[model samples]
Target: MRSPTARTAPPTRTPLATGWGTRVLVVLAAGGVAVLVLPLVALLAATPWRDLPALVADPAVLQALRLSLLTAGSATLVALVLGVPLAWLLARDDLRGAWLLRALVTVPLVLPPVVGGVALLLLLGRRGLLGSSLDAWFGLTVPFTSVAVVLAQVFVALPFLVLSVEGALRGADRRRALVAQTLGASPAYVLRRVTLPAVAPGVAAGAALCFTRALGEFGATVTFAGSFPGTTRTMPLAVYLAMDSAPEQAVAMSVLLLGLSVAVLVVMRGRWVGGLPGARPPRSGQDAR
Candidate 1:
C-alpha cells in the first residue's frame, strides 16, 4: 500500500497547463494593450523627425513650454503643501464622513475639465460671489491670468496626490509611530520624523503624477485662464492651437509631451510598484532564503 504522505501528495502542474479560461484572458489582455499602445505608436510614426528641432525651437512653442513647466511645478508644490494634511485626515479611521470627504476629493478626477473651469470661473471671476468681495476689497481679479492656470492645474492635480498619499498612509505599518508617541514624542515630532519618511515613496509618486497631469491640462486652462501666449498658454493649449494652424508643430508638441510623460513613468516605476496599494515590495535575498 502507498504511504500516507504519497497518498496525500497533489499532482504537479506545468506552467503550460493553463486551460481555455486562461487563454481567453490572455487574448483579452493583448487586445487591451493594443488599444492603449497603437495611438502612441501612430503618433511617433507620424512625427516629422527632421523638422522636430525647428518646430520645438519656435518662439511660441518655447513660451508654452516655459509656461507649462512653471505652472505644473507650482501646482505640484501647492498640492504637496495642502494635500498631505488632507490625505492624513482622510486616512484616519476615526474621522467622520471620510467616505463623503474622499468622494468629494476625487470628484475632479471624473468631472469634466470644462465643468471645473466653469465652476472656477463662477467662484473667482471678477464679478463672481467671493471674487466680487476680493475685487471690492483688494482690487484683484483671478480669471484669465497665469495665476488662473496654476489654480486650474491645482484643482485637477490635487486629487492625485491626496489619493496616493492616503493609500500609502493606509498601507504603512504604524508601529514605530505609535511607539514614538508612547515614548512621549510630540505628535508633530512623530508625524514629521516617523510617518512622513515611511510614506515618502508614495509622496514622490503622487507628485510625479500631479506634475504630469498638470502638464497635460487643457480645457480648464483654456476656459478659465485663456490662451494668452507667454502668460497662460501651456503646451497642451499650444498643441491644440497648432493642430489648426500647424499640424507638424502639433505633432512635435505631442511627441515632446509624450516623452516627458514617459520619463516620469520610467523614473517612478519602482516607487509605484513598491509603494502603491496592492503591490508587495520585492524581498531581499536573505528573505527569500
Candidate 2:
C-alpha cells in the first residue's frame, strides 16, 4: 500500500479592484489637496515676518479684534438661545411644514452674504418694514450700528448651530429621555438634565463653528452695519480696508484669522471624533454587576 500523504490546499487569493480608475482617483485626490494647501503655503511664504508684531499691534488691528470678538461672542450666545430649541423641535417633534421651516431658516447659508445684508437692510433699515415702526415707537435704529453687526452675524451663523444640534439630537438615545419621562420627570427637567447633556458635544462644536463664521463675517456686516472703526468695523472689514493702504498689515490680519480658524478646528476635533460628554461607555455583563 502506498503511503498516503496529506495534501494541503493552497491559500485562496482575493482580487482587489485596484484598476486604472482607482489610480486616477488617488491621483486626483492628491492634486485637489495640493491645490488647497498651495495657497496657504504661498501666503505664509509671502507674509511680512519682521513687521508682523507692529502691524498686529496697531490700533486698527486691536480695534478690529475687539469688535470681532464682541460681535462673534454675542452672535454665538444668540444662536445658542434660539437654535438649541429650534434644533430640538426639528429633530424630535412632528411639526407640520418642518421641512419648509428648516429650508427657510437655512436660506442664509446658501444666499450670498451681500444679498443677505441687503435683505436685512430691507427688513431692519431706518425706513424698513418693522424698522420704521421701531424708530417711530422707540427711536431704536438698527442698521448702520454695532447691533447690526451682531444681527448679521447671527443671521449667517444660526444655521450652523441649528444643523449641528439637530444632528446630535437625531443621533442621541431617546430611550433614556423616555425613561426619564416615565419616571415622572418634567419635560423641562428632562431637557435640562438629560437632553442637553446628550447633545452637548454637538452644541459645543456648533458654537465654535458659529463663532468662527461670525468672526469672519464680511459682506453682510459691511452692508448692514457699515464699516466704522470703533463702532462696527470687524477684523474682516479691517482686512478689506487695510488691503488698499496697508497690504502687509492686511496679511498680518489674515494670519491671525487663519490661526484662530485653525485653533477652533483643533479644539473641536475631539468632539467630531465622538468624545462627547455624558456619553457612557458600554459595560460588560460582569462589570454591570
In terms of lDDT, model 1 sits at 0.91
C-alpha RMSD of each candidate structure in angstroms = 4.6, 7.5
- Tell how far residue 157 is off in model 1, in angstroms: 0.8
Off by more than 4 A, model 2: 1-17, 273-289
The positional error of residue 86 in candidate 2, measured at the CA in angstroms, is 0.7
Candidate 2 residue lDDT tens string, 27-111: 9999999999999998898799998999899987999999899999999999999999998888867788889988998899999
| Per-residue error (Å), model 2, residue 217 | 0.5
* TM-score versus the correct structure, for each prediction: 0.92, 0.88
* lDDT score, candidate 2, position 81: 100
State which candidate has the highest TM-score: 1
- Model 1, 1-289: lDDT tens digits are 8876774434344576489999999999999999999999999999999999999999999989999999999999999999999999999999999999999999999999999999999999987878899999999999999999999999999999999999899999999999999999998998899999999988887888999999999988988999988999899999998999899999999999999988998999867655665666545544333
